[model samples]
Target: MGVGGRFGARESCGTARGVLQRVLDADRGVFETVARRHWPGADALLPRLSRAADHGVLWFAVAGAIAASRTPRARRAALRGVGSLALASATINTVGKRSVRRARPLLDVVPLVRRLEKQPHTTSFPSGHSASAAAFATGVALESPGWGAAVAPLAGAVALSRVYTGVHYPMDVLVGAALGVGAAFTARALVPTRDQARPPARPRAEAPALPHGAGLIMVVNSASGSSERALALRAALPLAKIVECEPQALEDELERAASLARVLGVCGGDGTVNAAARIALRHDLPLAVLPGGTLNHFAYDLGVEDVRGLARALERGDAVRVDVGMFSTEQRRGIFLNTCSLGVYPELVRERERWAGRIGGWPAGLLSAVRVLRADRHPLEARFQGRTHPLWLLFAGNGTYHRMGVMSGRRTDLADGQLDVRVVHGGRWPAVRLLSAALAGPLTRSPAHAAVQVPHLHMEHVSPGTLLAYDGEVTHVRGAVTLRKLPRALTVYRPMP
Candidate 1:
């Protein structure tokens, strides 16, 4: 670069170092006093604690334990903690240490008895161990305040151990702790927190029951969980026609059933049910949904938790009319029963699916969020509400999903005739806003993000070939897209109150 630029950079670096050294000088006397008078037992124990956190094994073990716990909230907090640690480590070890290259405190100042068995040789203005501890603790707290509270003491202990062991100055430890907290917030922005449960879906109108599923054809997805319970499904609705189909043949099978049966039924997860909803809409046939997916969000909302539940609903002819979300791009038009989105979420879904089989969905989802957020930084370009700007995610929910944590939940009214439109606005620190939303939710609202309920929205000037995810199915769409609610367009079987 130029001489002026080089001089300016050096001046800035010098100023920072001067300030840090001044802080260290002020605390050095107390740090030395603590180091000289350390207890004999702690002399050995403190070093071991430092080494345990050296490669971050301690934090990883703690995170793994939390993730392995049966509690869902604990698992989520663990992932968030780990993700924050990852960010802190990267910043402290690579960026902070390399750029500043601050020398470690002289061991001579410390008492002979307090000298560590193995002191670090690298530049050490900031303690990486302190950073990791602080970041992990802060990240966990963002997810679960109670768990965070539990971890705070340990985090403080770890941060203090850096100075107690004579490896880092009090200032270094303090700076590391600050960096760590910043890392946790950064990770939060990238990964969404657990979605809170919404109020139950409100039942709309109902239809008369059919006898033993007579004249009803059910397309069963063999890949879905229903296949394992095939016998139970058959026993539940013996008179209904069941056609087992693979993922590839699901649409064709549903189409054939739509033409042949008076009522079309589907036994699968939300994605499968979403497909069935489209066909049911086109064929003007009422849908019978049997809850069979992992979460069964849609089926549960429809009040069909099992085959028997569906049968009872159908036998009683209890059905409800629900709104559908439609998004049309230049390539094609489609429908959704739950939600659609662009930006970080679609990539998260793809990553989660890739790992879900090996580690299960929730854990895989957390892992995927970390991986994608750490790697994917660029924002997508899209135009909405007459303005073109970068965005992290633009979500449109069928019928207005209630905001719950980082994700949305069940709509109180399924036929509300509105799309829940939420966008994480792109800005100087889009990730920060995203993380704040994930943690604090709508309470973090500002110019950086927005959420609204609307009957229709036209998203113009979208980049061609941008991926739009709807009901877990991703479609590459180019150009402008229209998102509108199909008010009470599809009739679906549900239990009567």
Candidate 2:
């Protein structure tokens, strides 16, 4: 570049800075005048409020209270809220304050008795308290609307407190609030809640009534919580044949039930229900679900919440057609009713299982994530659609998912005939990048992630014997793998109309 071009660029930057500085100075004058007009209650209340918000104590207390609730939704909201507050505080205090140096409002205009007891010494272009307040409120709102609404007024007061206490100008609080909101949104994209993305499924139609399980063969897991309801089921459908099997013999028992039954009934967790669905599809028989496991994700979606509901469905013969996911490789081939995942996830699952008994599900999973994520594991080298990339995780759902959050999405129509595929592209700090993308939102638009919906996919692992998981079950496979959807291949009974 010529000397003249360089000189012109420098001059333009100087001019822009000068204009911004002038605007800042004028805004400061107006806010200073506003601060000087101390109202009756303002003198006593604003200072104390400002002190409460110092170092984000007020926001932390509120978030802690919400987090302490036994309700899952309240707890999820707390996690998001705290995460947002942490992000906003880091940005405003470390980055925003240091980037631009600005002086706080002069205390001379305020009454001596009304002076802020504890004043901040850092640059005040952006107010950290205000930023924290906005971020926490916005994050809570994103997770739970009612809780967010309740906290909004307090958040607003905290933001305004900075100005009222004469520690920051109006514009500082305004800009800080925007930065806080942005931080909350960024936090949300990276650490989304699955419950929010997936809501309860509404039943399509009532099942046709059947004669007390006349042609049904119900496979019950004697070890499952659903087993407690076995007698109830038998009382409800005396003619139905019930086969109680242990966990070790579940597969064989299901296979046996498949050959003899007209409608195969499953009473277990998602894993058991999933196994039954695959068998029912193979034998071309309708499947009835009796919710007897923790979470009961599949049975809940099937619209049969309990044994009674399942019995009602069987009496009515109410059913729905749903898609299944197929996985085929040289060493192994199977079908999944929910999802298939490849990469770090299988390892995480294994780690969780090892500790799930000791720590419980969610806590064990969290510890497992911390353990798996801290390790310097190499990304899985895989080929997809004629392109090779290092991937942290590759997930494919059976059909178009309705609720797309951190967890695999939920499908409204089980027969959508499309697979929801999401891949996290590997890069520096692969785990951190993956976590950020997961929290932030859709990975397709993100450089660290890619997503698509297709009828089928063929994936090839560069190395042999890589671990893969389907419906919470993991296995090792070599070389090329294929996944396709079997549209309307399974008939499932639902109780609701």
Candidate 3:
């Protein structure tokens, strides 16, 4: 309570108020400057642009267009964009706007033509439009740089339109953009990007560097709906022989190609790739995969995403040796490059195949899932390890499948020589147990499901007609079925980072 203490406290309070007043003065000055400035075509363009951004219509349209590309990476980028936008929008509405009760800027100096027809009636401290634009652009860029580059200009224009329309001060848009970027990073922290979760490059292998794909023979499955990609690949590798065949003739065409080629190549989905893998193994040829299907799990995991990536690998002769998963019974045997499963998933795959040709892939998959889960089904009984157990599903991946954020499963290392086995125990509600197991993912033991990594798995006393799905193809197994890995057995082409 002394004189000196009281004076010092008063001085500090006065200084803080002075700084706040100066900041407000500067922010208002900048707003007035932008409002009075004459910019060509902005009067007509910015107001319309700002109006178009209302309720995120512009961003959603952009996302839809990006998703229509039909590439996995494009789809992922679109999803990430929307996810980031959702987070930023939620935060702005819930916290940013509420915490600061600032009013909209004065419209006296702003050109009437540049003003929006219907002004937003909300706090102006942080612009929600700017936040959403920044979040979407940042999120898309995180997943795909090319798409991000294309989207960033639109985002920037949207943010600037907020200020140009006399709706927000410069600081509002800047702070909103900063918060938007923070939201994108927060979204990424919750679900790591694909590049962040890429597996380590190890156990490299050797293969011939065929410039322009001189000795590569590729078979394209016509049923997989990859004709456009096949044509692109043909243009990329002019010297390579490209054979397009029907579904029934795929195996025979692959056999013929493998017999005549130095490097066996295939373009299609996982099932077509599986057939090609078998042929490649038999001929002892290094395989080149071009992803041309709805879900190219094997091709994607191998880092051969498109014709450009595969062409680069072939030109540089870059390659790696990866493990192959095999499942065998008393009557039949087959190899898988991705995963094999028994139980509900196999049935889903079989059902999907039935309707896929008729209704198209994505819609058919949705229909199949609904049909399979609603039907009355019984659990498969089999002996596992040393004891018999009733199981609703048994999934064995060629390599340990890692869970990333909301992503179901992805393998980092393809040559780790281990099988990722997950079993959903039989329970009262099949749907609930299956959903729980899927959400739990790998290396976690739950009442609904248990996951384990093993070099081999043995299941005995299975019925003769038990269905098994491997690499998106289904087959029947009887008696004892053994699943094992072939360590570093398959050589495949890929670009090295």
Candidate 4:
């Protein structure tokens, strides 16, 4: 792959990117209302939080109910070590923040929804409270054998409390937690004691330095079900940095891939392929198609006819820019704001969402998909831009679909700054026809595949079965829907070849 792509933000995120912003708002609400003088910078908070967390996690992990829960010596060492390193990390971060000196919240004069009860003291660039909570929590996770499992949630709750109480910005909290986790991990790494198997540091494979411009690596998941696409990635692209996109981890990984990618690829369905494009904003990474599962859409976009072609794409591939959709959030993870549905498709996903390992793998997902298509492809009312759109089904996209899909064609240009919207006014017959055409394309002559493309549209499931699909996966928000364009809001990676 050769060149790069561009991206932008969605108007939707402006309104719905509330998870972190809400936390910030909450901080302004309660904390600023109470205090007027100062707030801690994110950096300052990390060191302090790290020290506190190290103390708490290490102590409780080995000394109390956690240890009594049956702690192993090596695990105990890793936990204690994690705290020590966290403290060191805090020292470095606090000094760094001080030097950076970002402005704190306007504790003194900023308007509030309510009157202040008191005042606060410290810088406000980063959230000290959040950092502390994250550090403390992560440190605990590092050290606790098993019984102390409650630490993670407790820490997260405390961090949220900081936002709820108005002590720190959401970014501050995230940064602080990052510091804490870094410290704990560093501390753990320093422990001479894995005294166990060889540490990652001592591994033979690590001999190759990850060059600053290391070749871009993409890990696509294609398994229709719960096969370890992750495992496949770890095995095939060991040199590439690893980021897991298991349903729960997709958003985080997408963010990482967008930021660090040279090329991005997937291993799942058309959904997974589309999911990758959702975040493929501006990083302009050539996409490499890898087939691990089934119905690989983005893979198809790359012109890889089969698994063998997937390998060939990686070998003799060229870089191409692609369009992507953006989302506000997912009930379980990050939202792509595009179509990953469920009413019809979700019914299928739901059947096996909980089934895991081999028993809950591909067969189950396949069976579920078929059942939902046959039983739950319920039609619904929809609204777009502003008009009512009566429909049997709908799929609004971020990128234009010109000819083929992932692996078959190029990833559409991302800088075009638009949404690729497709709607299916489906009924039983059309659905059947569409399915038949999908299996054997000559059926395209049928009315069932009444698919067309547009930009900036909205959808709603009035008849409601559960058709909310976000970034290729199903979600649970049914009713009048909205889809707004956020042009070029993100960045993705491409190869330099």
Compare the candidates by TM-score and give the number of the best one: 3
Against the reference, the lDDT scores of all candidates come to: 0.79, 0.80, 0.90, 0.47
Model 3 poorest 10 in a row by lDDT: 195-204
By lDDT, highest first, what's the ranking? 3, 2, 1, 4
* lDDT, candidate 1, 1-497, per-residue tens: 99999999999999999997887678787778777774757776676777788788989988887777534467779988988999999998788898877788878867665666788888887889999999999999988787899889888878878888789888788999999999998776666553323223344555656787788898989888577455666777788788998989999999999999989988888899988988988899999887667656777555555565677888888777888888888889988888899988888888888999999989998999888777747788987767888988888877665544344455656787878787887765655767765554532467778778889998888887677888887878778889888788888877664
Error of 3 at 284 (Å): 1.4
lDDT of 2 at 143: 80
TM-scores for all predictions: 0.58, 0.59, 0.95, 0.38
Instruction: Report the lDDT tens digits of candidate 3 across residue range 47-122.
Output: 8888888888999999999999977788989999999999999999999999999999989999888888788889
Q: What TM-score does prediction 1 earn?
A: 0.58
Best by lDDT: 3
Question: Candidate 3 clash total?
Answer: 0
- Tell me the tens digit of each residue's lDDT in model 2 across 184-252: 998877776543343233324333456988888889987775666778889999989998989899999
lDDT of 3 at 430: 91
Error of 2 at 293 (Å): 2.5
lDDT of 3: 0.90
